[model samples]
Target: SQQGEEDPQALSIQEGENATMNCSYKTSINNLQWYRQNSGRGLVHLILIRSNEREKHSGRLRVTLDTSKKSSSLLITASRAADTASYFCATDGLNNNAGNMLTFGGGTRLMVKP
Candidate 1:
């Protein structure tokens, strides 16, 4: 089984600043996914890039992948107060008993102050 690990469990940034977070995985994966949780709410899928892709961008979110290193990074540009939430990365592997499942990291809590 594979699991995701994130660094700097928490972060604080100004409304207009950029927020960056990193995630590492313990095993090979088919794809990596980034999600955001608004306080006590369920996670919302932020982005999903395949293993072969290097970088992906969606609005203010940018994700980078390094398959050789088994690591990924998420960058949130021009933050806003609404962006304050817990971000997590999930690892997806093909060989699994439960079909397509995601192993989530502890998460990085981001606080965007106005």
Candidate 2:
């Protein structure tokens, strides 16, 4: 069953602002991943944080995970117009099989004005 849930259904920001998004899940997860999609097109993988890790960063993206709370958050620093897109958080169960199943959240629409 899908367990990921994203917050702030929608967000609007300026060219150089910071944007924060949140996600919550309902079950144990091996890892949580964040992705960005522009105009309903292909999704761009942003960052992935393992359940054992507290926080991770990649360039302008920051991700934090709290297994106890079954939640995660993604932060975008110095946002740009290109950052305008739909954001989603996905979680993979703790199954150690070669085939992994990913459950994605509803998604958050972000609009960054130029």
Candidate 3:
């Protein structure tokens, strides 16, 4: 079963602004991964935060994970037109073979205006 669900089916923002996306899951997860996909393209791994970590940063992206709340958020600072894409949150359950099993959320469509 899919464990994560992203809030705000869509988002629109101006360039240079910040975009934040949230995801909530139903099960305990070992780690959460965020991905970005351009229109009709494959997903690109953005960042991954383990259950033991609260926050992680990669370039212009910041991710936070709260195991207690079963939620995660992704923040993209200084948004650009190129940042327009669909963002997805994936979670790996706490099972022994969970590493190979990733459940993905529906995703949030972000439109960054130039």
Models, CA RMSD each: 1.3, 1.7, 1.2
lDDT of each: 0.93, 0.91, 0.93
lDDT of 3 by residue, 1-114 (tens): 558999888999999999999999998888999999999999999998999999999999999999999999999999999999999999988873636588999999999999
61: Cα error in model 3, Å? 0.4
- TM-score of candidate 1 on Cα atoms, chains taken together: 0.95
Error of 3 at 22 (Å): 0.1
On residues 1-101, what C-alpha lDDT tens digit does candidate 1 reach at each position? Answer: 33888877999999999999999998888999999999989999999989999999999999999999999999999999999999999988766578578
Candidate 2: misplaced stretches above 4 Å?
A: 95-99
Candidate 1 vs candidate 2, TM-score winner: 1
Please count the clashing residue pairs in each candidate, in the order shown: 0, 0, 0
Summarize candidate 2's per-residue lDDT along 1-114 as a digit string, tens digits.
Answer: 448888999999999999999999998999999999999599988888988999999999999999999999999999999999999999998863664688899999999999
Q: How many clashes (backbone atoms < 3 Å, residues ≥3 apart in a chain or on different chains) does model 3 have?
A: 0
Order the candidates by TM-score, highest first — what do you get? Answer: 3, 1, 2
Q: What global local distance difference test value does model 3 have?
A: 0.93
Q: What TM-score does each of the candidates earn?
A: 0.95, 0.93, 0.95
Candidate numbers sorted by lDDT from highest down = 3, 1, 2
Stretches of candidate 1 exceeding 4 Å from the true structure: none
